[model samples]
Target: MSRKLLLKAVEQAYSDRRRLVAPLLGFPGINLTNSSIKVAQQNYIEHYKVLNALYNEFHPDAMFTLMDLSVEANALGCYTLFPQEESATVLHSSFDESRLEFMNSIEIEGDSRALSYCATVKKMSENFQDSMTCAYITGPYTLAGLILGANKAAEMTLTNPELLDDVCGTAYEKIKTYAEMLTSSGAKAVCVLEPSAVMLGPEQFIRFSAEYVKRITEIYSESDIAFIYHICGNSMHLLEAMCDAGVNALSLDSPETGMDIKKACKSAGDNIIVIGNINPAGKILYGTDDEVFNETEKLLNETAEFPNFVLSTGCDLPQAVPLENIRAFMDAGRKYKLP
Candidate 1:
């Protein structure tokens, strides 16, 4: 399908409150068994079938690639081990800043896993050709966390600003390359997963993360592919900086970032979409279906004035989230129509 049609369907589905099912569509912090992860990789066709079944049951309009963190990090010199019955974990880093000179010389694609991720993008494109398939790229800031260690990166932001710049720059280059690969491989949109930027104050976020994000989005600005920036914490302070980054969409976790996002988008005169503020863990993951439906309705109603909003969890749905609860989200989307 054309990218135009894909986006239109997504908008229509959301507007009419129709369900749009996308696999690995958004982050769900829920853990999957190693076996499930392996199964997802080895039998994608089969996995697509399962996703289709869910979509059929729920009547969602789009599909997303299964969630996997191995792609970008592994490409940039991180190792991930998928445990059979446990959550996948990063086992090691290829470059450590303590040895800054050595890390600087390590090229992104020079790492074997990066090549594998490029291949995965091709495979996923072929697998989800009929639906709107979104490819995930680690946000430069988030990738910095993986490379420098979240705690180390946070500390360096204040104590060693230069080091923070070096680390973020290196990771941004790698993520930009990966984003290009995914877009070329037919991803309808690229979701920049920047959960860590929320940790910084507004000034720090602008200094450290905003420019890198802008750099990435600028590369894809002329393309039909969408650039989505997801900041998982209370980013009310950095909302304008994020909007200025030139993303096609801004995803926030709840409680609402308020009129700042609406005002920022207006100020920029850019048609950026807004997504999510639902409590993925608390409401969607563990709450009753009724709770999910009610909360979703509340969010939709509150954001109804915004034409480009997409309803979604504040973060990823837990791996073991009740399928029924997920269905409730879709159901609520279909039930709430804009006036």
Candidate 2:
């Protein structure tokens, strides 16, 4: 399909206030492999299959592939291994300051692990190009957690400010590079998954996370692809900072109140799009399809007239979430009409 047609499809969906579906339909506990560095090579194909399957089954307007978070960290020499039936985990925690220091020299495209992510994104774009809104994940501060150790990194934000800059800066550059690659490969938008950003106080979030995100946003501002910042925790305080970071949209967790988010957005002059606050774990995952639809209806009503709003869960849908609930989400989107 032509680029114009692809863009038009996405635009029409947004203009009609249609909720675009993402590949995050599976639950968090679902298995993600990390057997070897070489396994990274196959990450794209494996994830693509899941996405393809989901697309075939549901036929959503858009889709995304789940790449292991440790992809970049693994390439940077961090020891990470995947366990059977469990998500990828970092086996070792020691940050080689030397590696972090030389991060600027690292080439994101050629790095073994980073390349795998890029390849997976490319394959998704190639296969689902015109039909789906392709997406890639860059778990921002969470990536920092893998490299610096979450506790130590949080401490450094307070105790060693300079080092924190280096860490975030390095991670930001890598994420920016990866984001560019994904867009070039045909992603309509890239979601920066910054789940750990919520762990910091507002002050710390501003100091440590905002600028890094800003740098990336600035780089992609003119591109056709949109940028969304996903924070899977209470993000009330950092809402403005996230907006300032140049994100085109925000994805909030179910724990966050939609009223609070709307208020914050209003205060920020409604600068960015708001995607979600559905309780995926409690309501969508465990609840029945009717229950899911009811919850979705509540959100749709509450967010009415809020341009650029998209219905979604607080975070990625868990693997164990009832597929019926997933269908309910899509069904609601299709059935919804503005009054």
Candidate 3:
């Protein structure tokens, strides 16, 4: 854990003025193993095959588990749909407060699929010893959204704010338990995915998301685990608020969403590593190899002044993203040097 870590590796790379390249190579890398999304995510053996295959193909600096947002909700007894080729998702519905009480009684670690996620990381640590072993966990506010339904959750924020807080506090407890399990399974870092938080304004975002995230960060600070706060889409307006969460890193979306990558790097300062700006579904998927290479090199150069930075995608890449494009993107990272 001490040596196969994130902060030290990023700091060393920063001092050397080198970039750590770690795309959110989740479902797209499944092509490397010839496995379906459902099978690979539920079975640790299949999951390892995909991740190990990704490492063999790209040899990126860090290895991330599949970017599935539904695992925590499914573990809580929510009605989740598992398509053979896509990530599982919780169905939208109204829920009762008593349901949260019922879900609280259900053990999160007891869920077989949730346990498989830990096993997937366990397998990663055993094989990808030299690379950073990163895992993704549900953010408490986002999990509360799953429990209360997205629309209801947002409405509750304005109407019955207390009710939303109650649900969020309970959800935080569940996410914390699952996070501890991932840590025990040997995860060096965990990214708190809070895609739903995009619906909240700065103040509400802090109250619902960042505050709980800060506590989670404190819990793992003793173990030296790097906690990254990742909210999908254009979180440009919420960047400073996200920084206040006290995590080690912040992964942002592409500039297509009007996000200013340079300003994000400057705002995070030295405490957190700024990762990403490349659109997962952008040039890397539809453009030529040269285009992919140019875009990556440009992004690397734009944020080059910040030592605490990593080259990554704004979100998880699609499973069909051309392999040659990923190769081209990695090529840019490998070839670039700070000017």
Candidate 4:
């Protein structure tokens, strides 16, 4: 599809009388298929099974691929761990500038895991025409954090800003290339996950994370590919920078993490979509069906007045989250009427 048709799909979804329900599901959905996260991450057929399972059961307005922050780092030679049933995790490595030549020389699209995700995106576009297809990319600062250990990345911020800036420049280029791969593979909506940037104050966040994010979104400025920016923890102070980053939407954390979703939506105003606020680890994971329904309905009552809001979990649900709980969340969202 051309970019205009993709933009039309999203616009029609948003304009519908009902609010769109799209949970940031990845591993939890894999449980429906006879597959593990490790297998799905490595094999495209297995990944499409997960996507099919989620769409068959929950029928979200949009479908997001498995959320893995390790793709770019793993492609660039960072040490990564792949648990049998969990998403891959990148280990902290000491930043050594001498290694930049080798890392920069490596082509990320050649990576097996990166290729698996691209194939999954292409499959989603081909197989699932009714639902919007979305994917995730590691944010520049987060990728830089993986390149340099988190503590070192933060220390270099004030101690050696020049070196840190250079590292982030490398990260920005890598992320841009990966973005091109995903977009070319047929991902209509791509999210830049910047979980590691939550620790920095607003000023540091804009300089280290948001600015590069702006540049990444510029690649599709004329097309409505739905660039979404997501941070893992509370980002109350960084809402200004987040809204100014030129993304079409913001996936915020749960109120339990000290993020007031109502306030976040107000800050986003009418232009940007607010995709979340439900605690991934809260009621939906531990409470009864009634509890999850009440929680979902309560959030809708509070924030559905904003036409741009989409009902979703704050972050990806854990693999252990019971399937019945997800049904409860979806049931609540589907039953509610938009204000």
Q: Give the candidate number with the greatest lDDT.
A: 3
> Which one wins by lDDT: 1 or 2?
2
Error of 1 at 31 (Å): 11
Q: What RMSD does each model have against the real structure?
A: 4.2, 4.0, 1.6, 1.9
Candidate 4 per-residue lDDT, tens place, 240-309, comes to 9999998888999999999988888899987778889799999988999889999999998998667668
For 1-339, candidate 1 gives per-residue lDDT tens digits of 123443465567656754333323432212222235455533444445544454445544445555555556655556667675343456545455665555455666555444544555565557554556666677777777777778878888889999889888877777787777677767777778888788888788877888998988776666677777777767777777888887777766767534243453354342666666677667777789999889888867776666666666666665677777887888887677776
Can you tell me which runs of candidate 2 are displaced by over 4 Å? 1-23, 26-41, 102-104, 129-132, 137-140, 256-261, 264-271
- Candidate 4: where are CA atoms >4 Å away? 1-15
Positional deviation of residue 212's Cα in model 3 after best superposition, in angstroms: 0.7
Query: Once superposed on the true structure, which residue ranges of model 1 sit more than 4 Å away at CA?
Result: 1-35, 38-59, 91-130, 256-270
Q: Give a tens-digit lDDT track for model 3, residues 1-339.
A: 332257788888877767889998978777887899989888899998998988989999998999988988888887899899999889987688788788778888788988999999898988896788899999988998888888888998899999888889888888898899898998888999999998789999999999999889877666778888898878988988888887889999889987788889888897778899799889998999999999999999888888878999998899989999999999999888776
Q: Which of candidates 1 and 4 reaches a greater TM-score?
A: 4
Q: lDDT scores for all predictions?
A: 0.65, 0.67, 0.87, 0.86
In candidate 3, how many Å is residue 129 off?
1.9
**Number of the top-ranking candidate, with TM-score as the measure:** 3
- Candidate achieving higher lDDT, 3 or 4: 3
- The weakest ten consecutive residues by lDDT in model 1 span 26-35
CA lDDT of 256 in candidate 3?
A: 90
Question: Scored by Cα lDDT, where does model 1 land?
Answer: 0.65
